[model samples]
Target chain A: MTSASPLSRLPPGPLLVLGYGNPGRLDDGLGPAFCEALRLRLGGDAHRAGPHRMTIRDAFQLNVEDAAEVADHDCVVFVDATLPGPGTFSFEPVTPSTRRAEFTTHSATPAGIMGLARDLLGADTQGYALGIRGGEFGGFGERLSPVARCHLALALDHFTALLPRQEGRPTVCATPIRGEGVHHD
Target chain B: MNPVLQTDTERIVIEPVTRVEGHGKVTIHRDAEGRVAQARLHIVEFRGFERFIQGRPYWEMPVAVQRLCGICPVSHHLCAAKAVDLLVGGESLTPTAEKIRRLMHYGQFFQSHALHFFHLASPDLLFGFDADPVDRNVLGVAAAHPELARQGILMRKWGQEIIQATAGKKVHGTGAIPGGVNRSLTREERDTLRAPVSHMLTWAREALELARGYTLENLPDVGHFGDFESNYLALVRADGAMDIYDGELRAIDPRGEILLQEPDSQRYLDVIAEEVRPWSYMKFPYLKPLGPEEGWYRVGPLARVNACDFIDTPEAEEARQEFKGLAGGGPVHHTMAYHWARMIELLHCAEVIQRLLDDDDLLGAELRTEGPRRRREGVGILEAPRGTLFHHYRVGDDDLVTRCNLIVSTTSNNEGMNRSVTQVAKQRMEGVDRITEGMMNEVEVAIRAYDPCLSCATHALGQMPLIVELVDEGGDVLDRRARSGGS
Candidate 1:
């Protein structure tokens, strides 16, 4: 991690993991799915789990109003599915975006929201964009695609390791994937 | 491409109107004489949630339908919950259940309105209408006026917090269900929200003040920008006070006289009907008695404030009085005044939310009661953040939805939006064959006033989100533009 990265200077508290996207759209539901898997792996607690306890939330999409919730937390992790290559995912640090020209109430990008948390709410909230590559975004269903399911397992293991480990749980191997800024699983 | 003759009339299109939700295109046609011939705003995408929802169980509607639009899911959630309530049994809700739903609706309005004014509209209001396109957005506003932008973000934060506290989560919350909600408010949650109530009120007042100041500064532009007289539609209480959650549907003429008042949502079919135009996927809804031409009406904050007699809240009432006087008691026709009215509603929502939180009845144990499914057809009507929303569902004897129809706020204002775009084109781009980027941006500003959710109104399936075309009188394309990436 770079020394200038905001993620390096987080305060003491449970990390906030926010997963947002349209769950009805097949693999677009990966973000919420990640939150669910993380909760179960951390002992099935929605708000707290394991040694590095974290609060988990899932929503259809991000909005400007979400910056407030981000402000009160020490560290945040935003998870979502992207239209990139299949079976590939990236986890990159989020920086305040200065090029966000237009703002809409209905939907907002994670970087744009992070900017709001930092610039508007004066929160030292730092975060990462854990983007899992999605294959299908059409049709309304609560199931994931084949390739998305493959990436989900490894992605969950990588995120599970980021938190404080609890005793009696076996940790998965962490190996780097395809993306340049991605974490290993 | 063949070069058009200099003497021929030109067509101009602004596709993918920026700074609004979803995909929409604006088209302007010029005649042989170089005069404006036609202008229309077209809805481009069709997800068809209405058609796909046919086989789902009625109980799953509140959760399923809210996914139609991520921007205003609360509106859909509460509206669907109300409609499903009718199918379950009676139209009445327990006091606690009703109050919790009301608080959630207020949160929707506050966050939606603040997002519009501060992020979408402020850049145009603070900078000139003809300002540089790059400097005419949220980033520019932040760079020049940091304090104002910060206030907007923080205020929206409070609104979301209220949603999480009462509704369980901000987006696609399962707190609200048929007949009543799933849970009640806790004292801790109530006290936490109470602290920001006063701060929100103060900030909303400042926003209103700034809107009034800007309106005065640009009197000429405000008067003619997309200005047109039209009918109004909104929900009003029995006492004629503005109510968003539950109320009777009321329609008033252009002169502010009552045209129709239907106490039940079921009676909506008797007074209102829809006409599908060939050019767009959105349906045009109009009053049945007046026929299609004269039936197109407006909704949203402007219509609600104009259709009502008084506001029940004190500060909102004062603001409403000032807003009413803007037109000397007549309907304010200036399109820009929508911002001013939106601010007033924002204050009203904040005030009402505070009051509902203080009411100890929200903690009652009787959160919801069971009712047998007796009705096959039910209609739910309420005021969404954009305007009035209608949800009608027909279920089979098995309690499964057979048919679903929706008339969103954007569809209700379809005629008005088309008229506004035509007026702007005629007033600003009549003789010019080539328009500047700034002029195109001004046309979008007019549509932004209504804050239409094109994603919700869209009923057809298409890949392109926005496509603008300039066509000659003979239908030859003179110029064209398309916008990619969802707006």
Candidate 2:
């Protein structure tokens, strides 16, 4: 690839992703771990993770504004594990500014957060946050259990059925913000 | 009968303006020969929040009151969380958690600020009321500045996502659970935030540059925030960062007098007293030490700028310099300058959010800690895009909330905005002959400069019509006003 290629122009720019939290806490650090898997799938070239043609961050960082920032872009597939929610898995588009309470964390409802982002970015952006249900929620579980790990470890072949008959990044997740919960200080 | 021009000596009144967050009115009278003599702005909402939350669960208080607004939820989330954090006995949260909270707030800033610029105030900046209703809105902005409109929306998403993932949701933010949060992030997700965060930083700078190049307000433009000299208020970390979280409640006058810097945000009533009038539902708040006559203040961008010494991030600093250069000082007190301040904050939010990603602790495992068993009553405060927001609640022994109080951004600056409107009217329209719809729109935009979300401000349901009116000396109406929205 030529040095002038768009893909080669990263690393020097501002950081696009930084997954924080303790991986030992089970679902806590599933963010970075998910990206690591995605990174590998992309052959370290974020674009290879399916046809969406994204870096690891470009692949995920799912916010309405993220779409606008990359004008020529299409979709974002975020991957993360949630602790002790419903058994198995669930998928839904996030809205803006709505907040939901977790056992240990006080977060805005994914709906409200993304909805607000949509309001800000308007027609320029659109994306989704994918959450992985985790077995280890309380205290410290130290590692992704079999179920959660399997979810993160799934290959591209598995993702094909999730979206549709598409090659490049398939546009997804268009929903309004809906959620409500109190955040304790 | 006197000539039409001579009727300026008659007394007139406008009960309430329409399509705004809170209640307010305009009174105009002719002194002698029929020109407008005296005009005043009155607030009508009272202090329901302080009176209701005397005994409530401190932890649940913030969220309970957060129902106050569909817009600017993060401000209440931060303020309430910080106040309760102060009430509860606990060490500071992990830096990672703090950054997460700040990052979410920045997201709030991006969305709220952008909303103010686009959805609420952009029409006046770009098109007058004369602009076709069908194409005057986002369409017009898209036509005029598509790139800016695009950036504004996307940046908001990044901020909201950071908060949403951390708290499980974004608005009515439930992320800052007492003792610590109830959730932890996955490493991969943290990495994902990097790209959007970085992209936002670049775009935010572009936003700042664009904002610097254009003045968001004109004395006679539609959807414009006019200039007004008033007291400014906001909270700031001792380090002078862009404080949306915890800090003493400080008030500064136009001359920069530190009127009050109470360590407790709940003590807002002591330092601040709200005034209600027959004309409007929105309350006017002024320093208790200084009566309404002496209490003219402002909030939002200009207020935050005046109240804070400097911004926390680098791009914000550059934007801050440009802001100073615009109004000829370290920061601005003019309400219109809020447009500039809002963009600067958007840039800061993007930059600070990225810097937060660099922290390895974000990728660490230790995030939440169980709280010691207890029930407490408290209030939280944060500067929403509009102004200060207070969420107070009372929970019983069983951990169920029994009472709630919401002192939203509109309430915090009700008194200030009322005074601000009168000042703006006097300065921008008093001596003018042609007071067309576009001119009146400028007056309305001044109130919108605070980006008041009446739904959240009053915790009131429905898109009720908020009214503002101008009255003459003979108790006759001169101009009755309501916003000409999407319709």
Candidate 3:
């Protein structure tokens, strides 16, 4: 494991996993699907009640109010589906964006929320964006695409291995499986 | 960004208007003499949700329709629930169910208005329209007026909490069921929400003052910004009091003459008609009697304030009086007054929420009601954050929805928004040597006044960036400039 990267050393404080996208739209449900998989993998209440102090939330899209919830946490992982890219998934750290020149209440970016938390709410919360590659986003349906489902499984496996294992759960990896870092913008 | 022209007659297209909800583009055509000839707001995206929900079971409507919008899903949720109430013979809900629904609706209004004013519209009002783009957003508001920005965040948070308490969750809540809500507000939830009422009301009042002061202080410029006389429509109580959750339809002309007033929600089709234009995906809804050309009217905050006889709440009623005085006893046709009117409604929602929280019915055991007979067809109408929203459905004997038609707030204001763009285009773009960022924003400001939610109107989803293209008279592209992200 490379200690030079922030992802190598997880924050000891409270961590929030926020999965936001329109679940009604096909493939867009990858974020919530990841959260669901993480929850089930961690067992009932293990993610939240465990020693890691992690919280999971699902939303249609990030908005202005999310900053408040994000501010209370030491770190937040914003998960969403992305168009076809170089890999199955990309996980990268995010910083407060100084170039966000406009505001839309309907949707907000992870960096934008972090910026709001730091600037308006006086918070120093760290943020990360996890984009799972998906094949379809053009229609409305509850189910994810077949390829997106495969990517989701791979993403869940890769992400859960990085988490602190539960008492009864299987062994986990201490380092990331891949080093491909992609920005969600 | 580069500005260059190649022809005397050309078209300027502002694709994906910023700051407002959904993806929309504006096209302004100039004549040979360089005068603005025509301006049209085109809704580029379309989601046939009305057809998408046709075969679904009637019971799934309240939950299914929430997918139409992410910003105001509660509005769609409650409106569809109201329509489904008729399908299941539950039009007359129990006191508890009605009050709970009212509380949820008010929470939507409060949070939606707060977000619009503080996050979307405040930058333009605080900094002049021509201010630098870098320092003209909520962050800039945070840097300059930290306290106001904080209040905006907290106020929106409190309203979302109210939704979480009444509804099952914040996003895609299934609290409002077919006959009634699935759950009641627990005493603990009520207490948690009640504790923040006074502060919200205080903040709402301060925000109102800011909007009011801005409008009055800039009357000359604000009044003439896309100013025009058009009919206003909204739902009002029987005594003509402003009622957002439930009431009868009322439309009034610019001269304050009552154009139409129908108490029966089911008979809405008899009085209103929608005209479909080939250029835009959205339909223009007009009063049936006046026909399409003359009947295109405005809806939403400005229209609601003008259509009602009086506001029920004390503070908002007082503010309404002052707002009405601006027109000297007629409808306030100034488009920029929408911000001021929106703040008045925000304060009113706060007061209404405070009153609703004090009622014991919210904690009551009874949450559902049923009528003597079922209905095959039903129409639900309510004043959403933007304006009056209509949801109509026809159910088959098999319990499946056979047909559905929804006239979202933005769709209703389609013609009005187009007119606003035309007015602003003429004022800002005509005879201009070069098109500046400020000029583009001035046109957008007029559309922002309506606070149009294009996502709900078109039932589509997509990100929008600001793209302005100058097209020659022969449809050739002369120049193009693009800006990433929304305002």
Candidate 4:
């Protein structure tokens, strides 16, 4: 993976990276932990536009109210911890989905939120879902498992490489890598 | 699709009921003659949160317990903070502290109820319960009723802004501490919240009218759907007004006779006890005097409205009167009335918030206070959006929590949900050769009425989908149908 700054090559518009899961549950904290790492790498100027602006947020789960926030951004990447898979991580574009797969007040999928943003708020924001493989999810603890930490590092490296280059080629992965980390429709 | 024919008695199971908070399932049993024998609601996962909190420092509880449920974390946070206030001998908080906490709580109620009504419940109402699974969802609602759907999203956002301002963040906020709040609302925060009050009020009123109109228009169906007579319980102010933040315990029978009144929060154990049944992970709570069988009662919006004498807010009070008139001065046993009652409370929260935003006390500097002596044990009881939530704790001399017990709102409504499922099963599934999707949804709709947060009740986690299975008496799988999405 390239050590160059990923933000420099991204689309020139506001970007929202939301990482959500229960930090109290072991390995479930992978999302927030990844956000913390990304924030540090971006430094204090992350919120300001270098080439493009970036905002990072963490929550216990995605909710219906998040639609408004998503609408305000030009692009959004939803990061979450997935059950152990063959690959370290999987990244895919998220389009509006009318399907209500397990939709509830407590949680909403990236596709569902994107759908709400488009349908209710008339937003044209591009969306992507990034799922990092996790091993431990049974107990209540703040620390991430060792294997999950390794996967997180690898996933971060792969994500940084997947960003668009300065030539302004396509910004994100169009085709989903079929893996356990990818959520099936 | 039709269920396969079987000779012996059969059991139909609906696993991971959709649209509600967490994971749970429903099972219906049929006798040899295809008569509805019995139905049960089973909580599938268990986290043992009470046991999880033990050995932790008492001061860590308010924030620690928020991990119980992502949906109602603020409810758990405030309720735990209230309990810890007693442990620290700070039960009487400064006016500013109390108001801030109340504001935070009202924000929780507003947002939670809005989400349930607009997203979870409205899909079933807007499109009939039997509507195709593909079109029965919030997205579908948005496509059909854009304006109403927009109002729902904005209403939810407004309430969430209130929570963010008061609680310090939207998720797992730590503003509430042992003695009092961490800070008071700043002038800027106050203005930001105040600007949207009128708009929120208007939307709230419109939503209430929608629920009221639906209930009245479909009275015959709504009234009879999962309808049954039982006891009602909630936390009511001393003067018998509806008070969700803090109050004494009140339980009224189906006839509106007070069975238990003005019981201290500390005496909750004396008034109610939980009975463990072998079939499910959730426990059934009942009035102590009546025993398990006869004492089981319902809680949440329906019960809160029935148990309280009147709502303090004028708009909610008028709505409550009309809601009560549905029964001609009697308690409303109609399960579908929960949606209407929830709207009333949502409007009341908006009014109360509008009033509180004007109070100088919210901007006051006095944030916390503590008494001279400390207490070893304490109990906190408040009406969460779902129902009355109880949090109790015992602290050791070292300031570590020795024990903890949480009776979440959903646990209180467990028996009621089971009864509703049974009623729907009997009404829609009896003598049917095949259980259609519509019949399955009828059972789910009954459980959805209570808005049970199975995650909060069991302290577990999972994404739920609708799965129905048919099994013979010998536990052999006869047929199975599964849906990718839930209710």
Best by TM-score: 3
Q: Write the per-residue lDDT of candidate 2 for residues B218-259, one digit (tens) a residue.
A: 434322344456777788777655576667788887776678
lDDT of each: 0.79, 0.55, 0.85, 0.84
What is the total number of backbone clashes in candidate 2? 126
User: What are the per-candidate TM-scores when only chain A is compared?
Assistant: 0.78, 0.53, 0.83, 0.80
Expressed as tens digits, the lDDT of each residue in B1-487 for candidate 3 is: 1123235668888978888888888888888777998888988878799998989998898898988888899999999999989987898898999999999999989999998999899999999898987888887887889889889999999889888888888867888997888789889889889998999999999999999999999999998999899999999999999999999999999899999999999999988899988888899999999999899899999999999999999999999999999999789999999999999999999999999999989999899987765589888899999999999999888988999999999988899899899999999898876788899999999999999999898865677668887776786766777887576
Model 1 lDDT per residue over B1-487, tens place: 1223233556676767777777687777677777877788877666688888999999999888987876788988998998989887846788888888888889888988998899889988999778975677776777788888888888877888777776888767887898899888888888888888888999999998888788767778898889988999999998899998888999899899899999978888988899988777888999998889998899999999999999999999998998889889878877888998999999999889889988997887777865776788888899998899999999998888999988898999899889889988888888877676667878888998898888778732223434566667566766665544333
User: Could you give me the TM-score of model 3 versus the true structure?
Assistant: 0.92
Task: For candidate 4, report its TM-score.
Answer: 0.90
**What tens digits encode model 4's per-residue C-alpha lDDT throughout B1-487?**
1133245679888877888888888888898667888888888888699997899998999999987887889989999999989987798999999999999999989999998999889989999999986778777788899888888999989888888888888878888998999989889899999998999999999999999999999998988899999999999999999999999899999999999885579889988899998777799999999999899999999999999999999999999999999988778999999999999999999999999999989999998888865579988899999999999999898888999999999999998999899999999988877888888888999999899888899966666557787776776777788875444
Instruction: List, for all models, the DockQ compared with the true complex.
Output: 0.42, 0.13, 0.44, 0.45
Tell me how far the alpha carbon of residue B283 in candidate 3 is from the true structure, in angstroms, after superposition.
1.2
> Clash number for every model?
6, 126, 2, 0
Overall local distance difference test of candidate 3: 0.85
- Preferred candidate (lDDT higher): 2 or 4: 4
Candidate 3 deviant stretches above 4 angstroms = A1-9, A44-48, A86-90, A101-106, A135-141, A145-151, A154-185, B1-8, B474-478
